[model samples]
Target: MPRWFNTAGPCRPDIHYMLPALRRLPDVQRLIAQEGYFVVHAPRQVGKTTALLSLAQELTAGGRYAAVLVSMEVGAAFPQDVGTAELAMLDDWRNAAEAQLPPELRPPPFPEAPEGNRIGSALAAWAKAEPRPLVVFLDEIDALRDETLVSVLRQLRSGYLNRPRSFPVSLALIGLRDVRDYKVVSGEEDRLGTASPFNIKVRSLTLRDFTAQEVAELYAQHTADTGQRFEPEALALAFELTQGQPWLVNALAKVAVEELVPDISKPVRRADIEHAKKLLIDRRETHLDSLAERLREPRVRRIMEPMLAGLALGDVPEDDLRFVQDLGLVRMAQGGGLGVANPIYREVIPRVLSSTAVASLPPQTSTPWRRADGRLDMARLMEAFLAFWRQHGQPLLGTAHYHEIAPHLVLMAFLHRVANGGGTLEREYAVGTGRMDLCLRYGPDTLAMELKVWRDGEKDPLEEGLAQLDGYLAGLGLDSGWLVIFDRRGGQPPISERTHASDAVTPAGRRVSVVRA
Candidate 1:
């Protein structure tokens, strides 16, 4: 039987083309050797479970230490009922140990103990009864919340001292976030102000995303198996789109091979990759849908709203920023500013965010925006957008999740309608950069655009916007484009009065269509 890309769960070496698990996580063995208790965190589907599971098998097979990987996710089902959570968790650990370890290394039945102290007492019993020292990896530790999470952490902390005899010699808490980022909310609307109970952690390490070389190697496995190759451009484009997100990396390849080019004799190309990307986003797969759900979170909004709007993120709490970063929604950009993690996410975020507004658009109205030759007529599109801004923009703004970026969303929604069937719309926006750049591609034409906002307290952005768009256009090797400035000043004129369109020449003599709305 042949193997394919695995996206739904941990990659099995026999069935999946995966990087060497231990090679990716070199520090785990060292940390265990030092008798340390630590935390390992990474974004979802980055292979935390796969790495630890492989390490456990390798350690137990070495004939020195007994090791097993267990999960605390069952405890999350009973958040306030610590007793029940403990019992379920212990039962799971026993089953996991039985399946993964040999008879000599398997733990004996857990000793009876009270609800809150059950995990600690059980670990003590296992360590004392077993001949070999025990090392345990506790996965999904962050899923438990409120009293349950606190109780589990306190038990692990309490059992930290009796290493090598009465307690596990080394333990690892594995989850989507570091120890400090866990929120223990016990009935209060806000998190507990008390200090964290799991302070025994020696270090908090995160799993890094795959590098470009790793991506190429993984793809080569497919080529070696099926005698089908991915074009060099497609390979590089895959890395650029996913930025080494494990799920996305596998998903793109799976879609391209399994869906786009099912015949093994044919090679995958960049165009096929683009088609797969559109399909994935349009279908809203579970991974992408889950990310969209996080947009409603208050902490997420504080960071993401400004990012999409191309506004400066000011006075955001550091913890909130770190929390989003850990979730893999954002990353540090090339010049030290924070932005969306990758191009795929950059496309997914706005499309998901503006989906509601897109749905609200008028149905199938004919327009002169597309010429007889199937090219997008920029002047006509701009004129139609100004009319739309006057008629429906305010209502759409009122319904937007991020008020600061409402106009931007409304415009994107409109352009999406324009480009949905025959063309593509690409967006570029970042923190500390006060303008959003857009590239709209129709059959044979490319339209470059920049968006800015003019607030009441600020001076007119016309001169600055023209200058910025000039630089943006130069980079794209384009001579002319659009500069859209939205008027957000308070006590301003009516929408119909304020919305207008004109043209200007940039300092570099490139003609810029300026739309003031």
Candidate 2:
């Protein structure tokens, strides 16, 4: 039976693998045929290595190409020593090639390292003696030290002209970022552009996440193999939550199939997917941890902060945006705004970044809300939030995400606790939104909040606050809304002064309340 869920990488042969999408790239095939150097980059575990290995198998099976997939990841340990790094990389390559080669066609002794150009010359000599065109896929190409990486790229570029007859016909550098964005920063103000060494690269391809249809196709494979089916809603929820990120998609499916589902006879349901998501987040797997690490980077912060603030980031360099996109952190929409790439990522980001804040949240009163005839007391919830902010808001504000226009993460933590299980919070923020807008959906009742920070020496923010809240409520189809403003104008004021102040009125006959923290 096939393992439907895969997290490390794709399983061989029986994994219901998809190949046509990558094979369709024109440049990919051209390089494979004409002996060119290129790059295939995307977020870790998004299947860059898997796709390359699959291609390598296909090329080798044709009996017209000698293909090998080598990983440089192990060389990352001795990054500064080029000699040891090169040796480790070469050893990995030789082992992978020998293991994959058919017994009848295996070379007795692999090609030895030659002087001048270590990797390129050895590879060139191997191709020269081989009966087929040489194709090498260098995985984890970015793991090498800056100097060594430059040397390797330059060697490949120099040897490109001697293809099929004297050098490798096709060379691929697969890593976490595109080759073009590689900035080898060594000394003071010394930035070596990736293009300088790898100018011969005709194309850079990014392995994109599986689409909704693809996710469904992958799941159907398991059902066909073992007669264990995922419920229709469960399948939909899987795509909705994972947005087809390969690791998350496979991990969630694995949990549902191997753990959550009772037996082959029972169909996996949406609740199963929810359970899997919770387990994955709780476990804090390496895939999730690696992604969370990117959130702390300044470049990532610049791009993500504005989106969290519901405002557009103007004039950001294309490279920065592309880097984040490759990391699978954000996705661009047709309308030109950025959103959290997928549901799983969206959920993970808030949870990982707000751990401290969530732990310190104040306890709600037993009579948190007063009910009149089984209806929720919306006013009471607001009052509770106000009181909580007064006591714990400043301390929580210290944990606020500073890169964003406002402290959205802190506000989100507060809302997350209050609305947990009982309600849902929908977020809307883009590059140009200027403020973060959240709508709380509790049963049939709906409440909206707009969050902003005091930027300059503005004395009264009443007009801006009113306009913002009015727009949010209108969009949410609500009669009344709250505007929470954090007064950072005083530069970290005392906790006592961070009290909630409201000008109570129903402007435009739509209830509007402003809370100051």
Candidate 3:
């Protein structure tokens, strides 16, 4: 059978084109040799399980150690019942050991110790019974929470000193977060700090995404197997869009080859990759949907809200920022600041956040905002937008969840609705910036727009908005565009009094249309 890209669960080399799982985890062997207890973490589906399982097999086969990878995810279901969660987790460990280990190395039946201490007792009994030193990779250790999470980590800490005799010689806690990020909440919401619970961890290691060369090598495997090639530009575009995110790299290739262009004889092209990206975003596949679900979380909001508003983050906790980064949502920007991880995420974030408003957009009533020769008619488009803003902008802004970006989202939704068939809109915004830039592409025409907001106690931003738009237009090779400022201050003039449009010239001699609504 022909191997295809794998997106769900741990990748199997027999079926999926993949890089060596251990390439990004160079210290695992050394840590294990030193009898260390450590945490291995990365964003979801970045091959944590695959690497652990593969390493466990390799260790077990070496004839010197007994190794097994067991999952703690089942325990997460019984968070409130420590006894039941511990029992379930121990059972999972026994089952995994039996399947992966030889009879000589398989763990003995769990001990009859008390509920909360069973996991620790069982590990001690197994280590005592086994002939050789044992190593354990406890996958999804962070999935457990509250008392259950606390119980297991404490049990491991309790067993730390008995290595190679009364307990496993070494162990790894694998999940999406470091042990420090784990929370232990008790009655009345009492919490334990990081130092006490899982402090036995010698080090916390993170698995990184595939590098650019690794991504190419993965694609090359598919090409070698199927005799179909991805063009140079296509591979470059894939890396550019995904930033070497493993799942995204595979998903894009899978979509392009299997869905968008299936002719094995033909090479995949850059345009096909772009279309695949749009398809994935439009379909809201499970991966992207899962990411969107995190947007409502308080910690997620603290980091993302400022990003969307193009305002600097004000005193957000360092842990909160690190937590967001661990989830693969944001990364350090080239000029040294936080930004969305990649272009695909950059596009997905705003659209997903504004989906509700997009759904509520007024039906497009304007004739195609296109000239007879099929170019976008900027004048016609602006006329329709001014009319739409005057009619529905206020009501929509009132219903938006992100109040800071309400006006910007509403306008984008409107533009997205009108530009759906004939054009595409790209956006750029970042923390510490006070404006959102938009570039609309339609056939041979490119339209640049700059959006700013005047909140309470702030003066009109017309001069600054015009200057920014001038720079933006120059970048797009255009001499004219739109500078839209939304007046959100209280005690303002009525809509009829304040809503209007005018034209201005920039210091660089660029003409800009200024719209205040």
Clashes in model 3: which pairs? none
Which has the higher lDDT value, candidate number 1 or candidate number 3? 1
Cand. 1 TM to true fold: 0.96
- Top lDDT hit: 1
The TM-score, computed over Cα atoms with residue i paired to residue i, of candidate 2 is 0.86
RMSD of each: 1.9, 3.7, 2.3
Give the alpha carbon lDDT tens digit for every residue of 111-203 in model 2.
Answer: 556433677767777788777777888888776656677777778888887886888878888888777665464421233444567888778
Ranking by TM-score: 1, 3, 2
Residue-pair clashes per candidate:
0, 9, 0
Off by over 4 Å in 3: 185-192, 362-375, 494-497
Candidates sorted by lDDT, best first: 1, 3, 2
Angstrom error of the Cα, residue 511, model 3: value is 2.5
- Model 1 misplacement above 4 A: 186-194
- Residue 19 Cα positional deviation in candidate 1, in Å, after optimal superposition: 0.3
Clashing pairs in 2: 35-169, 310-433, 310-434, 311-431, 311-432, 311-433, 311-434, 312-431, 312-432
Cα lDDT listed for each candidate: 0.88, 0.73, 0.86
